[model samples]
Target: MTKSDTITWIRLSAVRLPLPVPVSDAKVLTGRQRPMTEVALLFADIATAEGHRGIGLTYSKRAGGPGQFAHARELAPALLGEDPSDIGRIWTKLVWAGASVGRSGLATQAVAAYDIALWDLKARRAGLPLAKLLGAHRDSVRCYNTSGGFLHAPVGELVENASAAVARGIGGVKIKVGHPDPREDLRRLTAVRERLGDGVPLMVDANQQWDRPTARRMGRALEEFGLVWIEEPLDAYDAAGHAELAAALDTPVATGEMLASVAEHRELMRLGAADVLQPDAPRIGGITPFLQLAALADLDHLQLAPHFAMEIHLHLAAAYPAEPWVEHFDWLEPLFEERLSIEDGRMLVPGRPGLGITLSEQAHAWTTEVFEAGVAP
Candidate 1:
């Protein structure tokens, strides 16, 4: 293809809409009510000579609301006329140029969509699978099922979910703990392990609900369950707390879901605060930054179990040696063109170029209002 055949203008637009997804027992560790909101993004290569297009999403029930639409609009002007082939340079420009507001959260997620689209477009141009382009790896990737279907479930119900996961061939499972009462949490852990038997690798996430003392107490009890790790036991911002917990606990203290910068992760590693790191692909800019973060984790002897977005995380984990958990949640299936393939408890890395997915026709219809509105940020 000639220079004229390449992408000439990138269009970044988004939609803020609610999906009709059922809550499958996922509850806030604090037992607080969940914020009801969902956000998704659509990026177009208006100038693509090959008719290549890609879509991405950033679903949040937290602080960043429909306000992400504003960030997406702000970035469109900057990327509208850039070459899709210049993915690395463009990604750097997007993240660094908006340091004041775009270094984290929705701003970073918006940039991530476009950056990931560029990679998809680039991969399409080269006729290569994303994993192959990223690194040489086995085509199939491992996965751990995170059946968050237990927000209000009794301890028995949670263990039932674990048994169901194992029955379906998954080898690992993640459970949410950190209820206000430490003893009750231990009771739940005991029931889950007893039901799942001794062989399954069980991981627990506190979702940043506990403080140092509470985390230490919970970690001590969890040690008996042989937990893979304890995730976000304390605040995500507390590096010293994590280091303290690591020192006090036998189960590895895991975090990094809320970290938005490479420097932040580097500091966490230097402090020896964690044994496993879980970064979200869309949350921390995009794959480019994720790879840099993964490299940092590898060098520091830390494991990279990314926070959900397992479809995307599968690619990253396949590229690296860190034993990762490809969080198995079905919330996005309503919007994806190709669903992730998991068998025998592992997620297979897609061989398609550029994130290997497109927006489902139904999802595009649902999101039409947000994109067509062209709402000002």
Candidate 2:
């Protein structure tokens, strides 16, 4: 067979690309103005070696590099001669080797992009969508509106945006809260809850902005609203604080986006830091590790609610029983190949191979010549 037809090896590299235009209005905390720097991942296609490719763009609000792109670059050399289809094995090898180096944090984040890209390529080559490859039993996964559109707006505006989401047939909604004043935060929560009504699932995330005592107080105050859960109420690393809050309040505690390693998940579970574990596919090493973490969460009887990147998270959640809600944020759709659709409050998990999502024509053009970042062609 010709080398092109035979399954061979994969090469890895990344593009230091900028968004079409600067997103100056983006947020982190306190409504500060910032621009986003994306570290786009491109895996060489040799086996399913078509023009097929995938992009895993890292969203660093501070326009950060090196640190963001480090994992893809560091792990690429080790992956040069490996089979693109051997994703599970590749994931295991990396985990075992990086065991002492640590699995959560930056190392896993980087590995996640590479593994996701490889999976994308594999799906495209096999002429199958990601959902089908993963043995999808359903065509779509339900999603919650996270607008993530704006966080520092006035109370009325927040309600309007949320109402818009509700009108769109979205069954769930998530809002950001971490204001220093307890009363003011409560008002915001109360306003949102009032707008969404009693039965709707309303969840709030503190972004790890509150301390232990303050978090407990806020959790208690918000309990009357009957929040689905209170998220990242304390520092992501403070297992003790999480445990304290979890034990003190009636509201279910949820956290894990800040955690990058499986060991941390183990500790958090042991401490009862949270009743819900939120794992981001790219944040905690990639699909393989995320799956492992989901398994752990399953064993712990905790619910799984992934942080963001709803497109990819849908598949991961679909594969596991624990994931109940997938955060819906469309900020990165312009950079992707295809947009994952949400119908009747559910997202259609890509039925094609790999992640089931494709690179959109605009995404390809943007990442390729125009974005000044070459994608695998």
lDDT values of the candidates?
0.70, 0.67
Itemize residue pairs with steric clashes in candidate 1.
24-149, 25-149, 25-150, 25-151, 27-151, 120-354, 143-346
Tens-digit lDDT track of model 2 for 1-377: 63432223444334344544333221344454344444354423233334455434333334333454554555555654465667788777766665676665656665776677766666676777665665555666667876532455678978888888878777678877877566667787788888778977888888787777778778878888787888888878999999989999888989988677778888999998888888877777677677778778888888888887776778777776644778887666765567776777777776556665545555545443121122233
Model 2 vs. true fold: TM: 0.82
RMSD of each: 3.5, 4.4
Per-model TM-score on C-alpha atoms = 0.88, 0.82
- Model 2 has an lDDT value of 0.67
lDDT of 1 by residue, 123-211 (tens): 66677767777884567665667654344567767878788878877668887776667777778877878877788888887778887
Q: Any runs in candidate 1 off by more than 4 Å, and if so which?
A: 1-6, 9-47, 368-377
